[model samples]
Target: MHIPGFDTTTIGVADGIELTTAMGGTGSPVVLLHGFPQTHLMWRHVAPILAERHTVICPDLRGYGASSKPPATGPDTYAKRTMAADITALADVLGLGRFALVGHDRGAHVAFRAGLDFPDRIDRLGILDIVPTLDTWNVLHGVDAAVAFHLYLMAQPPGLPERMIAASADEFFGHFLDIWSASPAAIPPDVRAEYLRACRDAVPSIVADYRATATVDIDHDRADLAAGRRLTMPVTVLQQDWGSALGFDAAAVWRPWAPDLHHSLTRAGHFMAEEAPADTAAAILDLLDR
Candidate 1:
């Protein structure tokens, strides 16, 4: 079922992939992107409130949710650049030449890239519960081993990760909702089930998306770093204190990419938007206003 008062659409993006997007409210435009193992419903709480004042667009990113899932042809196919273009085209379809952008997990990676690549398109940016992908991978170690197993697991060659995850998609994806959230009720029973179902149904496309990160995505990010490119607009990053868990300052790590940055830690778990919707919505509105 659709979120209350929101309408859904399946629009074809540039790369032969179609996205199932949830849209609501009216006024200035804002696009909210979802992360892994979850669909656009992750924004159910925050989007409506933001929709009160802005046009809120929530899309199941390329591989996840009800969106189209093309074969993984090559590494570049699922690159954030391609994914970022999908968002831009979605915004254009909605007649939003400039829109505020918010993303979490995998979606946040796309948002950060969108901000860098299309500075004029994403007027303001907010990333929840994640740092840059390369930054996280760079700081990995023995202590972080357990916490980051999914990254390693998904980053492996296509055959193994796909078969392993497909074998027990529910158990695998449900584990994140259980462990990553500070509270079980943070993701209601129905929503949790929906996430599991979607993940199970989209194993190949999903794994391909993750595998792209280990290869093509890293190359793009490294090239950007080499050029010293930084986000030109205001940026906000709200994350769980992985610093203590992973041993690096999350905010400090984000500063170089986003010079005009507002970064902070939250009491909520990795799914901050759901566990702390009021706070997450407030942070996002704050970013747009800045």
Candidate 2:
């Protein structure tokens, strides 16, 4: 599952946590974070393209893929604040004073937190297919919320969610891989198998990651919102047109957090980096230029 030109290694980013990272190219650094139910391999297509112009570092988020899966000892354990810190620590460990960051899905939450929490260290920010954490909760309601059933499932109490998901890990994780992509061919069979295998082995940590979003992550976002904290760097958001179907203006939702924003809609599925790597990489490169 390694990207052809990338070198993979384990780098310790926190106490007892080491991230499995793939790094390639030799220029300004850009770290790409993967979303739910997938690993750094999710960026296989897009990373190579970006690597041509920047040092592309793709890591398996702590709880997913080949990274450390510490038990969720407390709500803070998997909070986006904590997860975001891991990225900064990783950069620090790699001697990067500042770098551009781009994230998709759950990783987008982490990237958003990083942009807010460590503005000086982030040169530019790119978020794929997600609204801000607070905005996400604010926008989903009534029947429209049903589209995000997995959010509720994982947001439940610890034991129940862990047990429920573990009982049918593949089916649970595979559901997103199946339904979220408009172009199934984008994820070949081998890649799909790898994603499922990773998710299957990391159900508890994955659920813990999501559970933190419902609790501590929200608290952090609300505090930031109250403080009027915004990403100080240039930000680009590429998303499928879910706002129209779900009854909200996507650009409007992102504008407050990202004052210097470039928001565009993609015809590709939620997995835009895979389904539309050239377009995704182009947007990321454009963000770097800004």
Candidate 3:
């Protein structure tokens, strides 16, 4: 399920966790990080377009896909901060002194952290369909939080989430693939199957990744917020109109963290890169131009 015309390789980042990455193009680098239950393959349609003008690196976050999945030995192992460091190390290994970064869903959380932790290395930041981790927890309330039931499910202490998800992996993963996409045809049969298979096999690591959001990741975000740390790079956020329904001003939520922010709502589903590639590519190009 590699992106066509892209070369795939496994590069050791940090914590001895090697990431399986698909890379293409030949100019300034732009790294794309995939979300949960999916891999670098999500960028298949969007990457080629960005590749025309910039080198695009798409990687499966450490816990998912072909990437090395070390057991969550500690609270920080799967934290977004740890995942963010992997991107910095990867850029160092690839000789990219600085690079633009974009991510969707869970990956967007990592990108947000990277922009804060490595402002010098992350030239630009693009986020798709997510708010910051702290804000996410803050915004969800009462029945509305049910929209993200999985977050609460995975946030629980280890054994239960791993067991529950693994027991019905396909059904669990496939549920998001089905419900989140407004245009079902965007994810053809093959790609969807690949996502499910990847998720099914990586349940423990995936759960750990999510669990961190509820623990160490929040602490990190709180520290940054308290320190008045903000993303110094140009930031672009594209989202489905979930904020309107969920009762939060999406742009307002992002503005404090990203002073230089361009936020827009998309017609596409949560998987904007796959559902609306051309538009997604355009947004990345626009972000780069900023």
lDDT of each: 0.88, 0.93, 0.93
lDDT of 1 by residue, 81-112 (tens): 88999999998877889999999999999998
lDDT of 3: 0.93
RMSD of each: 1.0, 0.6, 0.7
What is the C-alpha lDDT profile of model 2 across 51-167, one tens digit per residue?
888999999998999999999999998999999999999999999999999999999999999999999999999999999888888999899999999889889998998998899
The alpha-carbon deviation from the true structure for residue 229 of candidate 3, after best TM-score superposition, in angstroms, is 0.4
TM-score of each: 0.98, 0.99, 0.99
- Stretches of candidate 3 off by over 4 Å are none
Better of 1 and 2 by TM-score: 2
Evaluated at residue 241, the lDDT of candidate 1 is: 88
- Assess the local accuracy of residue 194 in candidate 2 as a C-alpha lDDT between 0 and 100: 95
Q: How well is each residue in 8-29 modelled by candidate 3, as lDDT tens digits?
A: 9999998678999899999999
